[model samples]
Target: PKSTPAPDRHRPSSAPPAAPAAARVLWKRGDTGRDVRELQARLRQVEWLVDGPTGTYDDLTERAVSGFQGKRGLPRTGRTDTVTWQRLLGMSHEPGKWDLYLMGGQPAAAPDLRCTSGRVLCVSKSSRTLRWMIDGRTVSTMSVRFGSQYTPTREGVFQVYWKSRHHVSTLYDSAMPYAMFFSGGQAVHYSYDFAARGYAGASHGCVNVRDEAAIADLYAQVKTGD
Candidate 1:
C-alpha cells in the first residue's frame, strides 16, 4: 500500500464559517437616528437646513442638502455620504440646541469696536449684520450681504460720500435703491435679489440690505458724511 498516499496536501479542510460583511448605512430621507440629527444640526449652522435637526431626514432636509451640494459643486445626491458629511463638517461649527432649532430670537453679535464712534453704518462680515449706530449706541440692526469672492467688499474705515435714492448701476445695469456710496463703487443699498433669495446670492462689492423698508429709513437717517 503506497504507504497511505502521502497525506493529501491539496485537500480542503472544514473550517469555521467566515463572518458576513457589515452593511453600511447611508443617511438619506426617512432615515432616523442620532447621525441624522447631527447632520441636520450641521446643515442648520451653514443656513441650509433651516427647519431641522428634526432627528429624521425628511423632504425638506433632502432639498436643503441638494441645494448645499449644488452650491459646493458636489453631486446633488441629497443623501449624506462620507464625502458630503466631510464637506459639511469642514464648513460648519459644532451646533448648539439654539442653532439646531433656531429657538429664541436672532442671537446678538457684539458690534465691532471700530464702529463705536459717531454715526456709523457698522457692518460686520462675520455676523452678516448691519448695525446702525449713533455715538456708540445701536439704533437699529438688519441683515445684510456682501460681495462674492471675485468682488469682495472692502473692509476698514469708509465714509458715505454720495447718496442716491433710486440709483441704477451703470456697470452691472442693476437697480440699487437707497444707495449710499462709501468705498469706490461699493455702497449700502437695498437688494431685491437678497430679499427674494435670502443668503443664497451675493452682491457685487456692495453691502446689500434685504429689508427695503429698513434701508430706506437708514438712508434717510444717514447724511452724506456719516
Candidate 2:
C-alpha cells in the first residue's frame, strides 16, 4: 500500500557559532606614538626603564617591557602586548608631562654671547636648563624652574651678589638652600618643591634648581659679583 511519504524535514545544524575574538594590542620596538610614551612612563615609575618617555618604542623600552613581563611571570617576549599593557596599567600610575620628562628634556638653546666668554651660570628659559660654563665649555647642566606669569623670572645677565649655603627665604619663610642671590629676592637656589613637583609649580620670582647636589657644587664654585 503506497502512502505518500512525508517529505523529510531538514535538521538544524548542531555546531554552535564561533565566539567573538578579544581585541589585541601589540607594540614592538620601532613603534612611535603617545601610547609608547605612556608605556615608558609607567615603566619609569616602576624603575624598569630610564632615560625617556620619549614616545618611541626603542630598544630600552623593549628591554624594559620584557623585563617587566618576566618579573610578572609572563613570557619574556620583549614586545608589549595587550596582556603586558594591562598588567602595567594595573601596576603604574598615569604619568604627567613632567613625570615623562622629569629632567626637562627641552634642547638647550645656543649659548648666549656672555655664556661663551667665561665662567658663567648660563640659564636658558626656553630650554629650562642651567649650564655651568667655563671658558665657553659646558661643564654641567641641570633642570630648572622659573617664576610664573604673575611673578615673572627676570631676564638679563645677573651676578651672584651673595651666597648663602643654608639661607631661608625671609619673605616666604621657606628654606632656600644654596641661595645665590642675584637680583632682589630672585636667586638661583635649590627648591624642594621644584625637585618634587618639577615645572608644576613656580617660585616667587626666583630661579629654582632641582638637584641639590649640583646646586651645592655650583654654590661652592660661584662667588660674589660673578
Please report the candidate that would top TM-score against the real structure: 2
Model 1, 40-86: lDDT tens digits are 87887788866645577999999998899899897888887777788
Candidate 1 residue pairs that clash = none
- lDDT, candidate 2, at 143: 83
For all predicted structures, in order, the TM-scores are 0.58, 0.64
lDDT of each candidate versus the true structure = 0.82, 0.85
Question: What total of clashing residue pairs does each candidate reach?
Answer: 0, 0
- TM-score of candidate 2 against the unseen true structure: 0.64
Instruction: Give every collision pair in model 2.
Output: none
Candidate 2 residues lying further than 4 Å off, grouped into runs, are: 1-35, 38-103
Predicted candidate 2 versus true structure: per-residue lDDT over 12-126, tens digit per residue: 5678988966536578989987777778879988989866577789889988988998999988889988888889899989897666665566567787898987678899887
Residue 135's lDDT within candidate 1 is: 90
